[model samples]
Target: MNDSGRAERRETVAEHKRTIILDAARAVFEAEGLQGASMRMIAKAAGYTPGAIYAYFPSKEHIYAAALGESLERLKAATEAAVATGTPAQRFVAAGLAFFDFYDTNPRDLDLGFYLFRGGIHPQGLSVDLNAELNTKLLATLEPLRVAVLDDGAGADRARVVTADVLAHASGLLLLAHTKRLALFGGDARAMMRTHLCERLARGNTPESG
Candidate 1:
């Protein structure tokens, strides 16, 4: 009834439409990928006209970026939660496993994180700034694991290396699992991750033998 109430209602409606566009965009991206997907496809998936979708997102690339941003946020939350109750070493392992588990369970999110499209090696329409912003968001999701490695008493360089190792290992494992190739490596991706983290912890604790 009031002007303020009407404005709030409008804001809510706008946000709802934005969410609808993003949800449709995600499915379209997954199906057709960033290079192959179009605004029209996303609009059809969202049950809106192309003009209506444009009111929310300027391009399919922007929609993909927004979807990936949300996925990274969820990943960060999952990593933080897993690292909350463990010892430093345990927390380090927990963070790595959390990363693996997040991608392993959400294969589409993993695809989004990969930053590749159906017909191209790179996303074409994303601006440099937008790509960098998304990269920063993605790396932020791994910050917990890096911090946990540091808390486990590794030096900064060592922590960085360990964090990278975890990310690379998890990515490889998830790729194998997603493509049904994990059976070639004993078929237990999580167990391999656990073992690898434990080995890294042991090496960190071992005294150098001069």
Candidate 2:
């Protein structure tokens, strides 16, 4: 074909190949964990020769980083969508619920992105800046609620501190729930936590009854 048609076909092939590699990498990471997964295994999963995978990803770590980054971006989008139309408090709750839902739906991706591969491990010399970006996005997501809480009499610093604590608690609760450790708490754990956090924030901002 013509030059333009050839270029379009090449781009489509590249995109398809990239997706195949990512899918294979995700499976390998889920099955073998980050440290245990190998490039050969990913190539095998993708039905590509080992050298073919190298054309797309230089190493298993590179593939891992891409997969992890994609997962986090998807999560960020989900959170944004969840809070798009809600009030400040509703948005906050929606963000928390969206995070939990993401973990529930994509546990393997979550494990690879957040739990299994932490700082200090550079796969194929690939490093991801997920933590800083995630933190910034999360803080921005809470900014409206933060201002509202502070305006209700809580100090700005205090609101930030409490928001950080509540977020940490929520993350821990999600991890526990994902791992099935929260079964003992029954099904209302999320409701209980949400109620407790809301009450604490309101109490902290309450004016003296004098």
**Among these predicted structures, which one has the highest TM-score?**
1
Candidate 1 colliding pairs:
none
- What's every prediction's RMSD, in angstroms? 2.4, 4.6
In model 2, where do residues sit more than 4 Å from their true spots? 117-163, 200-210
Location of the lowest summed lDDT over 10 successive residues in candidate 2: 117-126
Please give the distance, in angstroms, between residue 42's alpha carbon in candidate 2 and its true position after superposition.
Answer: 0.7
Q: After best superposition, candidate 1 residue 148: deviation in angstroms?
A: 1.0
Candidate closest to the true structure, highest lDDT: 1
**Model 1 lDDT tens row, 1-210:** 999999999999999999999888888887787878899999999999999988888887788888988999999899989988878988888889999999988888887888544655465678898899988987888898888877877777777777888888888888888778988767698998899888888787323411
TM-score of each candidate structure, all chains considered together: 0.91, 0.74
lDDT of 2 by residue, 24-137 (tens): 878777777667788889989999999999998877766766776677777778877776675555655566666566766776765764545433333324454645554455
